[model samples]
Target: MKDTFKHKGLRQQLVNILITKGIRDEKVLNAIGKVPRHLFMDSSFLDHAYQDKAFPIAADQTISQPFTVAFQTELLQVNKTDKVLEIGTGSGYQTAVLCELGVHVYSIERQQELFRKTSNFLPKLGYRAKKLIFGDGYKGLKDEAPFDGIIVTAGAPFVPKPLLSQLKIGGRLVIPVGDAVQVMTLFIRKGAKEFEQHEFGEFRFVPLLEDKN
Candidate 1:
């Protein structure tokens, strides 16, 4: 039997985890169900990949728990025409989920090795992210400015001000913010001169650092 399917039992457990943890968006739940989390990790760890737990993947990075991914995606509230910017494409799992939901995804991975691997894996999954960038995610993507939505997977000490400038009016940015401890924050650009902020709750994530690799 494929280790991937063997991991299916964990999926139900993850659903319960999300429900209990407050990730109640139905679209997020469906996306979690459709995307094959096991395919995003090394085969040796595939059995535990769907267990509502984070696991180290490559380049000293980790794929986030299924709940984190679903919670973040649900926070973004993506629409079909939304152009989404994602920071830290660790295992391409979250990126795949965004793509599955019909967003035009532009994902940035500071780790070169992860970038190469995900650039290759995304197409194979049949969900093509618009671009896979290798650069400092902290700087955000300028040329692709005015994104309709943005999701940052890593924890940041503060929200990147430049990223806020790049968001289109009416766009939403969902990011985890803090030092070692973090809070998932939602930023909404209400208009050219206004924005709204909401603090969700605590979350643990790999730090968002500046790097070319």
Candidate 2:
């Protein structure tokens, strides 16, 4: 509940690190600088919150690294008023970042514990997504299909076909695909069933879970 000058200074230092690391989207950077990342983390980790790294959160998930979040979001290329689908709404940190950019986010989290936690916690921080559902990320929100962009916050062993099908014709799907280490992949929907693929380097993420409840 406290975002003091010290927190803001640390947040700015984090933003500077992101800039040096090649994250060029001003809006994305601004979003990164705006949302109180420390607030999203447990107080025990408050000291490390602004560091350019991920930390453990509830339900055994990691709030994605600031660089990772900025990178994925930059590739997704969201716009104000755009509809975006997010998989793995773990910490709601990424969710808040997306919201800060003025997009309508519909996020799915398979871990019921996280889903419930984030569902209640996000609005308290003044970041609200269009919908926060407790469900499988593999099964994209069919009811809210054709999103302008989709971001997967966890590591997927393979690209889920449903996620591709849920994008608008020109939409982008930013996901990390692999096992132990994931290659950050971006798929841009082209024609009816066509997509353009590109791969960034590599990053580690908690596994994207399927609904077991």
**By lDDT, who's the top model here?**
2
Model 2 segments beyond 4 Å from truth?
none
lDDT of 2 by residue, 1-213 (tens): 999999999999999999999999999999999999998899999999999989999988889899999999999999999999999999899999999999999999998899898999999988989999988999999998989999999999999999999999999999999999999999999999899999999999999887666
Tens digits of per-residue lDDT for model 1, 1-213: 243544555676677788898888877787787788888888899668768889999988899988889988998999886999999988999998898888999999988899898898889879898899988988899999999998999999999988898899989999999999899999999988689999988999999987645
TM-score of 2: 0.98
Clash pairs, model 2 backbone: none
Clashing pairs in 1: 110-213, 111-213, 112-213
Best by TM-score: 2
- Compared with the true structure, the alpha-carbon lDDT of candidate 1 equals 0.87
Q: What total of clashing residue pairs does each candidate reach? A: 3, 0
